[model samples]
Target: MAEPSPPSFPPGNYDLSSVDLDDDRYEVKQSAIRNKYTIRDSTGNVVLRGKQKMFKMKEEFPFVTDNGEDAFTVKAGGIMDVTGNYAITDTGTSEEVIILGEDFSLFVENWTIRDPDTGEALATIQSKSGFSRPSDTLSPL
Candidate 1:
């Protein structure tokens, strides 16, 4: 009897002419912008969520209110002390920003306001291009 042939793999000459490389071209474009600010207490509880604006120019970063009031300011080239927990979101870029406080308790205590979550200090809050506040002055997204 003739020897049985071994199993053969699929042929290499497959046709792929129907696949379109540029099919989904209308996806929403996202920009890189700092937009929203959310503060949480040490107990992992969210305390504050609002529209906080940051100004960054010439390597200096400062946190300000939506209407140009000083919320938090830091020196240029200095290390930023991020305390507690906070989240920042950029709607334009669809990026979720998170800041985790570290062992620098002294620095965080100095800048942040009273109240547990609010008491935590923020490090550098730099403003990227095309960042803006909403009309309601609540959240960035």
Candidate 2:
């Protein structure tokens, strides 16, 4: 008789392809100090987590997994960067993948998402004007 095979395991352990691209919704939980954030999928499964140290001159958020594996890192612009841009870097290569920056607009909140590698504009988020209040100025998708 042939020997029994070991139990099969899930493919792509912590691989990028293993991530569910279809699941867009994420449930977020933040610490009381707003320095730590826990992110979970819509099914209540922990997927990503982030932590930031307090009282830092420049903001840095290191996103990781529950088991303490580096996922990605986000470094915010210092006081000199007036546009309020943040760079998202890959954990392994430490290369900038995306550049997030805000656009200066009067009476509207505008944001621009770009690819740092190719310098291509990926998307733009613009808040509609005349919402009566700033809190409700977000434009519906």
Candidate 3:
């Protein structure tokens, strides 16, 4: 598969350039007891950390940089995405930039990264080997 292009974001408070998207080898470590998670590089440097509020009618995860700057958020709310579809929004502008939705597969875990506006499939992510998808493009985003 070709490298999956990230979803386009309009001019707003959302800034992708501020993020360290240079490395795709970062690992995600989730807290077993809660919704908190930390993203670390292969060398074990914390990249980004985030958590969601408990007891919400809908699920949302807001992430921030190690320096504590708001980065982005993953939200599941709209009628069209209330089930397995999620919107990754820019926290500063509250604009939905991308979507992660569940796509059915017979044997393995299947999911997709999509454009929230056009509903175009940007990438198909499968659990080929525990997050070892063919392309590591989506990791830093």
CA error at residue 58 for candidate 1, angstroms: 2.6
Candidate with the larger lDDT of 1 and 3: 3
Using TM-score as the yardstick, the better of models 1 and 2 is 2
- Winning model by lDDT: 3
Give the higher-lDDT candidate: 1 or 2: 2
- Candidate 3 stretches with Cα past 4 Å from truth are 1-17, 78-83, 104-109, 127-141
Q: What TM-score does prediction 3 earn?
A: 0.65
Record all residue pairs in model 1 with backbone atoms less than 3 Å apart, i.e. clashing.
31-92
Candidates' C-alpha lDDT? 0.30, 0.61, 0.65
Q: 1-141 in candidate 1: lDDT tens per residue?
A: 984343332342211122111221111112235534443344444333333235433222333333443333222222222233333322333232223332332222222212222443424332222332332122222
Candidate 2: global Cα-lDDT? 0.61
TM-score of each: 0.19, 0.58, 0.65
For residue 51, what is the lDDT in candidate 3? 85
127, model 3: CA deviation in Å?
4.4
In angstroms, the error of model 1 at 12 is 73
Instruction: For residues 19-137, write the lDDT of model 2, one tens digit per residue.
Output: 34245455666564445778888789888888777555566778886667787787877733434777877686677767888675446567777767565776666543433233222
Winner on lDDT between 2 and 3 is 3
